[model samples]
Target: MSQRVIAPKSRGFLFLDSHPGGCRRLVEEMWRAVPDPAPAGGEGPVALVIGSSAGYGLAATIAGLARVGIRGIGVCFEKAPGRRTGTAGWYRTAATARLAREHGRDMVFLNGDAFGDAVKEQVAGLLTERFGGKLDFLVYSVAAPRRTDPETGTVHSSVLRPIGSPHTTKTLVFDEHGAPEVKEITTAPAEGDDIEQTVAVMGGADWERWVTFLDGRSLLAEGFTTAALSYIGSPLTAAIYRQGTIGAAKSHLEATARTLDERLAKTLGGRAVTSVNAAAVTQSSTAIPGIALYAGLLRGVLGDAMVAPVGQLTQLWDRLTGARPLDPDDEGRVRLDTWELDPAVRKAVAERWSGATSGTVAELADLDWFGDEVRRLYGFSVPGIDYGAAVETDVPWPSAGA
Candidate 1:
């Protein structure tokens, strides 16, 4: 019998699943939630997606193939099968690839550090040899802790700290037993070069680099479009998120989108833009201070309108393919978070935020649902999966030998 490995807990979150069922359910949800595709009346386009193993990137890839019949190539950094539990992303990619194959659509996953030039070259080669030497869509959705400059070899790591001063806020922490607790946590301000370092790690330099490399190699098809994701939360999180280290990075990312838009238009008759997405529990979002409480409250306020990654990306596709006209903000960026930022929703969240305490958290916010979302990120808490059954962690790469 295969060894039985249970979920692991750390820093108040449980890491579960040594199987693929949970990821399969996520993909199934995406297919079921998205509206049926209206034929675009042409050959299907090819997509190149960076950070495509999970979260927004994964959702985009699945939506592209399943809804619109686009062939996709995904790039991500996930653990290969080994002694320790393989990353949930690994199973997700494997299951998504299988789904794509079942539908007779092509989906290739390349697991590697997308920040490096080597991976870029490999993707370019794949495009030339197998994908007709051009891409119609490119999606950049990487969220990394540290990034090493491919040119300077200097390493930059990002931090979740406020900008100018220490800020105290209600933070959520889970115990080993998976019980949620709210505590008053204070985060210090960014130190010397911390902002710059965070920007280097999380900013648009690498995104622009990818575009430049693809454009220079003539890998972008005529009238090609590319999009990168960003976020601008409510005033409640401005101190810790929008006005903080990560916010600075997002600002840079949005700025890069403008520059790339002009560059694409002038050079390749293409377009580029940033899509400001809604908040949902993602692997990266869970680590941000105060985000857990904020997300739980936001969900409570928005309810059914609260778009997850799958919904956000599906809506993005509608805008991109002219199924719906692009309704962007004044900055020419898609505001996918508009629903979450609606006046009524924001008002409700603010009211709840003011009265929320450890004892009152569950009553004030959707902690139970929020916790389930967090567990879903790691392929846990998903229905119909037998957690007690022995799981085989050794799974093949979805795009092996491709």
Candidate 2:
């Protein structure tokens, strides 16, 4: 172990260094929140979680192993520790593997460019050789800023902006005093191929490719189900969220779900759906323009009623496993953000949104919780970690970079 003291280093939401001990503790907390007693024996259910290192993807992997007793293959692109500490996703993946071993569950981590064909072929080989060529679940929760097209070699970058016109809204930012302040910010609309590029990067093109690859190889298990995570925020964020460039990509994703659902059902009696999740402080969400402000207010209004990733995924598992029947919306998407978009909740949040100002923003929103959640996502501000102590930064991933 290359032991050295590490402290939280940051510029805005970009967390520079990750704490191994703190990451392990946070994973432990998430692990404990789900049910225990993984499947006892036999080659059990199998799951392929693309982008499985952080946020919804990581939580879904945990839910699969701890609650559903499924063997998991996680694919993510993460950096290892070198001159500085590795990415938080790196440490989090290591900790999740440790817990999986403790519970006698099979968890494999493949660190690579998941958007490329090489990693997809690698995953296919694992399924065929190790898991009897059967896959029960494929979770697509990837959040990337850019993607290089495997066929054309063209790179597409996703953007966050209002669709047709510039939208001005109140956003939360820290003042020079490090106090929460509401500031009015206007985001420019998409120009040229901005919408097309975002749809290429964040849309369902890659997801469809993955499904096509596995099915062509005859690797899809009977009754196999796949899902991709999505979001549709309230009116307060509609200009920049539900009706933005990213939203255009999300629309494409949901459309792909319909197409995949039909094809999977015809071929293997399988299913595909997009799971629209609620707002929270995730690595990706914190980067969005107005999500932080909206999420903070949502947290304040719906405290405790706001489900964490693990809780939301556990419910999803129940729906998938026949413990409960699937309840999908008219669009054939599982709506997990119902609570977030409830009329009463929306009314309360809108009132708060309209009345918010720099002075009263902190009081009207759960700014403390929002800040803490962002810190915890990168393995800082986790309870009971001595950040000053020297710790190992060079943690090994069992099969990373292979």
Candidate 3:
């Protein structure tokens, strides 16, 4: 990695590398100096959050702790530590721990594979030893390609291909020029095992592990609620997500919710809800083969209708905590993306896609927003940053598949 800290490229072309995830650490710390609220007349209920790192996890963590004032433990299943120019979740976790400890707020951070048995046991112990053997709420939001079972010792790897007939499409990918242009591609349908494996990884196995563990230890509370996050990718991403191995996992995941709900309801009147958030470019979203084009279209076509995710997080946080309160639907997913299927938004973006003539992924992706999101994902989107400033030291670079 280069020692020189280039004042991070911002705006226009080079936006994918915007580094928004890095902001998590800073946001956590800033919440600290504000003083803690009293528990009796205090802020909100205490909670434990899994996947409280970058993307949705980080936002959910911040919104609960900061915006809605719910002090809690964040269980992040990723590698590394400390907040820096890179490693969005690591930095964010470090910052949250600091604030939480200072306020006498109980918070524990576990950086490991969520699928492992040891991980499951460690979390169970945390609940038993710390939070009085009761968790008022649980949020399971994990997106990973692989999982290892604790007992059966089975491993699952996900796939991404549509079912039915073999499908082929064109994708815009990066080249030596640091620009993206469309190219032809072919994708095959997933085999039966492929679907099962995908379900094992993306499905509700891990979710069931946590909930069952809680129930076994008798740590579950009455009227307790849990939710799993899911995405149904568009027609464009069907080959890589919906129709692919991952979709199979999601199907399993959707089913897991029902099973989990059945188990939980037998005890504390618990229910497992599913929240299907609209598509936005998180780290996971950006890596897909053809969705960049869909994201690009989302950008150009949505206009001001586009919801900057941080803003959306604020709303989501409120809904989740009942801070301000909300009205529920049949399945219990707060419909944030209710308007996503709106005829106007999709129709406009479709027209833009038809007229697209550029080799740049930015144009197809609502480049300005996409690029901004890329930056914000890493915590580099603060307003009034002096572009000319230089750092005197080198720092660890963010690693995706590192």
Worst 10 residues of 2 by lDDT: 35-44
Specify the highest-lDDT model's number.
2
Record all residue pairs in model 2 with backbone atoms less than 3 Å apart, i.e. clashing: none
TM-score of each: 0.95, 0.97, 0.81
Q: Which candidate would rank higher by TM-score, 1 or 3?
A: 1
lDDT of 3 at 280: 77
Ranking by TM-score: 2, 1, 3
lDDT by residue (254-302, candidate 2, tens digit) is: 9999999999999889999999888878999988887888999999899
Across 242-355, the per-residue lDDT of candidate 1 in tens digits comes to 899999999999889889999889988888888889888888888888888999988877777787788789888878776788776767689898888889888999999998
- Candidate 2: where are CA atoms >4 Å away? 36-42, 400-402
lDDT of each: 0.83, 0.88, 0.63
Q: How many clashes (backbone N, Cα, C below 3 Å) per candidate?
A: 1, 0, 28
Predicted candidate 3 versus true structure: per-residue lDDT over 1-402, tens digit per residue: 323343454342233232323454356434542333344224355566778876666656665665555644577764442233435565556656555555545556777777776766777777677666777777778887777777788887877777776777656555655465666668878777887887788888888888887778887777677777777746556667876777767767777877777777887877776666677778777766666667767767676776544455566656665654545465555556666667777777666555555554455456656555666555565555443455322233222110
Give me the displacement of residue 386 in model 2, in angstroms: 1.1
Candidate 2 vs candidate 3: the lDDT winner is 2
